[model samples]
Target: MRLNSLYSELQWLPRAPEDFAARLKAAIGSSETDVGRALQRLANYALDLNRLSKLASAIDKAKSGGRSLQPLQPFRLAVLSNSTIDMIVPAMVATAARHGIALEVIQPSYDQVAQEALAPDSRVNSSQPDAVLFALDYRALPLKLSPGDAEAASATVEGGIAYLQTLRDNIKSNTHALCVFQNFVPPAEALFGSLDRAVKGTLRSLIGEINRRLADFVTESGDVLLDVNALAETVGLAEWHDTQLWNLAKFPFAVEFIPLYADHVARTLAAVRGKSRKVLILDLDNTIWGGIIGDDGLEGIQIAQGDPVGEAHLSLQRFALELRQRGVVLAVSSKNDEGIAREPFQKHPEMLLKLDHIAVFQANWEDKATNIRAIAEELSLGLDAMVLVDDNPAERGLVRELLPQVAVPELPDDPSWYARTLAAAGYFEAVTIAQEDLKRAGYYQDNARRASLRSSAGGVEAYLASLEMTITFQPFDATGRSRIVQLINKSNQYNLTTRRYTEPQVIAAETDPEVFTLQVRLADTFGDSGMISAIICRLSQPGEWEIDTWLMSCRVLGRRVEHMVLREILEHARANGIRRLTGTYLPTERNALVKDHYAKLGFVKTGEDDSGASRWELRVEDAWPAAAPMKVVSHGFARPKETLSV
Candidate 1:
């Protein structure tokens, strides 16, 4: 049960393979269990260890290649501890070192120090460490008797919580730091049952309150929260259980749980500490089925309420739902009739995966590789963040060969193992769930709407106007900070400046006099695009402005919204005494679509780089006419009522 011990055993599996198996066998004990079963379990463990090693290697390779492996940087962790700091602090430090992260242990001795630590004016002591790892059990918070005293205690707890928020808020918003809350380790009921139920109840209540407040603050602030309770529970209490003889035992919890816990912490840190994958490509037919509904008919397909295979498919759908819930964009690429293949999703009673769940679905006779490319285009997601899941090896092979960037999992033939394998692959680990994560699918669906409108409408302008497209431009606010940072980090296509700003960077930009940061929200008859786009621009001097950054949510592309945004920025620049507007087109693997954007916008190129990046400028008099009559919405300022002649 001790994760440390588990890690030790796993570590031995590679160095002393025979000794590792022997120890495992001794642990299992001779109960007439077959060698095959034991060997199978050992093999599975070995495979998991190998996967972890590969992941570590990948991290090293990325770092060595200067790929910006964000998780490896020094992380600032706030360790809140009252007692047992000796036991927990070392364990945390060991875990942090294993992942190449620095831990900042915050142990306040008095209420004054606690207050000082949590004060808004208090700077994150760089001497202490980059991120915070909060290690305090709930008992650290003050508890008192008088109603007034209780109020004071409550205020202190709230203040402490706010201090954590302020530290998170003021720090570089884009810095990959996590505030992990470790829930109170429940005391053994056998030892403490008769001690004092009231005390226990109070402690429990305090812990619950801390969890509630911390969860809300972390989620709202877009900071990462490590569900230590969930993780500990997953590993099981028996493995991590508090033992009376822990101080005496050299090997705690069988020496295997140490590495296991370390591994979990490392993986969690890696997941939360790094960038999130952007796209999920799924296969249809047997992958989502027991039989092809296209050829077998809806009734003939294997899905049913009672069948095991059908139940397995349903379970997979539930799994997919969980991924969608976490903001990973889902796409379907199947070799079947577009209509016939979608029948199950539409009509099947057992089906939990709805049509709306998918953002880009390609149901056609085309090869999966071709279908995947089309899906990527439709979703505007780079091929790199994509994970293609298909049951058929042939289709997987095609995708793997043609779309090398796409992650294709080698699925087992058995239907029962499908869900488990996908879960183990860890493709959907979300480090920090942003508001945009929840609405990503809806945004993609909005893109589908725009596409449908364009196809149905007689002309491009008609489709544009029919979208009822209103671009709401607002200066960067707290609510929109995460989206802006996300765009700065992930956006490639249509990005002018390509300046990757962290959350802290964005916050700092707010204080600059020349910087103009705007978040664009688009909505039509479809639901709110929910802050789907962003623009960051700055003025260098009088009569001159540079487009530092401009990007629309991939979901909003191809609708001429980019043009509308460009025109708006130009209009604003003109009003601010800017006679010439300058912009840069940075070349990236996926941003070729915007290579000629400046030229298209009527800017004459003054210089060009070997990488195809061009420097272009346009005078106010010669700029493209702002005649694209799109409705406008501005927050913090109103658009001019009188149309100014461009």
Candidate 2:
């Protein structure tokens, strides 16, 4: 929502308040002494003010609705720098606190001291903090070169890249943390024509190298990279240069820029810290193109490259492609003739996204909700993992009413704003992409292959065994933390006792004396499901147990893996002399598919609650029907440990 606020502010800046303009002008008025510094300060102030106003408006909106805005949880952040940048610490701390994050300054006694401390052998542990901000100033580097020394300038750029590599290695060895590299801001000499043109060129080359290295590091390590240089450029450096006070005061940047920087840092941290939406469900007709294909015909539909309306659609397609490259799955769900709706994607000359680009395609005359349901089923993703994009408010309302878990972004009246609006929403902020993430869409596509194989087999057991299905069961451990937490948050349909837990909470839950946590990973001839399911249960007493949580990845749902997992739980319970197993079904908008699950499992209803949640129990002796041969390889413990410890 903060992202939306910032975007809305940017969209309406041309008509911003007179006071806002006056404040900006006043900031620039003192910036005349040094054009570059003044311009930077002015730009910083404008951006910051925009961020602050948006944040304030969001808070007011929340309060007016009788809902209090919850602050972000406190996260420890380490600022790694030297004395020269100590003054920046207070502003950073203030910004962090505004977002409910706590900043801990980790200043080295000197440059050498800091470098030595961050070395691989040093005591410094990068992962100990959520993130580390490296404020390395290139001006301080010992690069002996004159204005015209092109060779020397090239060497300086190379040295900067090498230093980044060193930093990457050291951080990798020490912590599971994110690294943000800040390029040094050029001094006034380079800006005011005091420095030779050649020297300026060398400095520019060094900055470019830093950007290159940072982008590379991000791609390779999947770490967050904050491009301060890019932010400055976005704020317009030339405009700030006209004001001179920034050069004179040295700290002339407005208070507003500090929070803008903080917002960027927070966004990066969020991306690196949590799971993001996995699927994008797009609507056809006006949503994907300029007009309805059903009425316009293939050629009549406006989707050419040169036309303005067509250009808007092209931008949206480009944005979708970018999301796909970043690992977001794309699916189509529209209410039209399947053949008619897909014509543009298949035959249009300017279309960038083809059928192969999408993981699932559902174009029919069914209601949008039904189409979305089918998409989720076909893709093996939960409804919550999807965000529906449609220009029709009525369709958006229907999905919101029927399936609350799916995020339906509000569409702008102007089609040109569609791409920009989605980018600002930050719906796809994944922290890290695991091996499974990169190939998830392909894995779902393999379902068709599985269906073919099933048709050839005589029966369920024979099909499963012939495919060489192997289910690996392991106790909750550090290696499977992300998958476990993701299951808790995203899984819904097959989930019993739908309780969501964060990573830390999952870890803490494992330490309970009565609790048992298990992860299920299945692999057969087709491919690896890669830790597709999780179950959490607790012993109520001797000979009695309760399933506190149970969820299987939708990908593995129809495989009867859920039945296999329940049987495994029963085996563990029986071995411990548990005579009965209990479970509950709480109704949710998206979980109707599982309403009769307990009954199908032979669970006798013992009672019902006012909220419509049903309580059921199964006798251990007759728990499950005879199940197919499921080979489970167990790890950690065959029985509960004598004592539970953190």
Model 2 over residues 138-242: C-alpha lDDT tens digits?
444544443466666667666766666677567655764456666554432343253443253455544655567667766565455666565555554442132
User: Which candidate's lDDT is highest?
Assistant: 2
Instruction: Evaluate all candidate structures by whole-model CA lDDT and list the values in order.
Output: 0.60, 0.63
lDDT of 2 at 21: 50
Write down the TM-score for model 2: 0.57
lDDT of candidate 1 vs native?
0.60
Mark the 10 consecutive residues where model 1 has the least summed lDDT.
Answer: 35-44
What is candidate 2's local distance difference test score?
Answer: 0.63
